[model samples]
Target: YEKSSTILTSNKSYGEWGEIFKDHVIAAALLDRILHHCTTINIKGESYRLKERKKQGIKTGLIRHNSTEILEN
Candidate 1:
């Protein structure tokens, strides 16, 4: 496995992964192995779950507008 390519996916960030694994040493070891030849990609955006709810006609209520003058004041 060490000489082969690999792919991994996780919803949690690296910092949160320590807590998720419940062992800092093991998490570090796991990361070291997985990341050895990995190309890390960070994909960040609004949750797909929320988008589905919106399409289902979920009421999100009014959108707030911010004025420049309010910030200046």
Candidate 2:
């Protein structure tokens, strides 16, 4: 990864990594290297899956929208 470009996606924030990964030290070390030459751009909105479900008349009942939208660069 250090010699080439890589792309990763995570819905959780930095502070939540300790709990997300179940180890603060490992999370910290991992983030340290990843963020060294990283560019972060956050996009917040309703999930397209839900949107399509709604279009198909599937009842989601007001659940929180968690979308994984791809970024093109």
Candidate 3:
């Protein structure tokens, strides 16, 4: 038998995932499964979208987030 690999990618950190899913319990379960026997790699850099905008002479500004509103119903 051969083993298969699964790949999951996210722009947010593990702690911030509850906001993305709107449920901390679900996020925990999902993460638990994916992280079991998994290897992790983190890549950091300026976003490609922002990089291209800068190249085209378009000004870009830092994006701000309000944590309180993220999981609002």
**Top candidate, metric lDDT:** 2
lDDT of 1 by residue, 1-73 (tens): 6676566778787778779989988899987776665577765655556777788999666353433221110
**Displacement of the residue 46 alpha carbon in candidate 2, Å:** 1.0
Question: Ten residues in a row with the worst lDDT in model 2?
Answer: 64-73
Model 1 alpha-carbon miss at residue 39, Å: 0.5
Candidate 2 lDDT over residue span 12-60, tens digit each: 8778899988999999998888788677666566666688898988888
Once fitted onto the true fold, the runs of candidate 3 whose alpha carbons sit more than 4 angstroms away are 62-73
Predicted candidate 3 versus true structure: per-residue lDDT over 1-73, tens digit per residue: 1299676777788899989999999999988777776677765655667878888988777554423212211
TM-scores of the candidates in the order shown: 0.63, 0.67, 0.67
- The runs of at least 3 residues in candidate 2 whose Cα sits more than 4 Å from the true structure, single-residue gaps closed, are 1-3, 57-73
Against the reference, the lDDT scores of all candidates come to 0.67, 0.75, 0.71
* Error of model 1, residue 45, in angstroms: 0.4
Q: Kindly report which residue pairs in candidate 1 clash with one another.
A: none
**Clash number for candidate 2:** 0
- Kindly provide the TM-score of model 1 when superposed on the true structure, using C-alpha atoms: 0.63
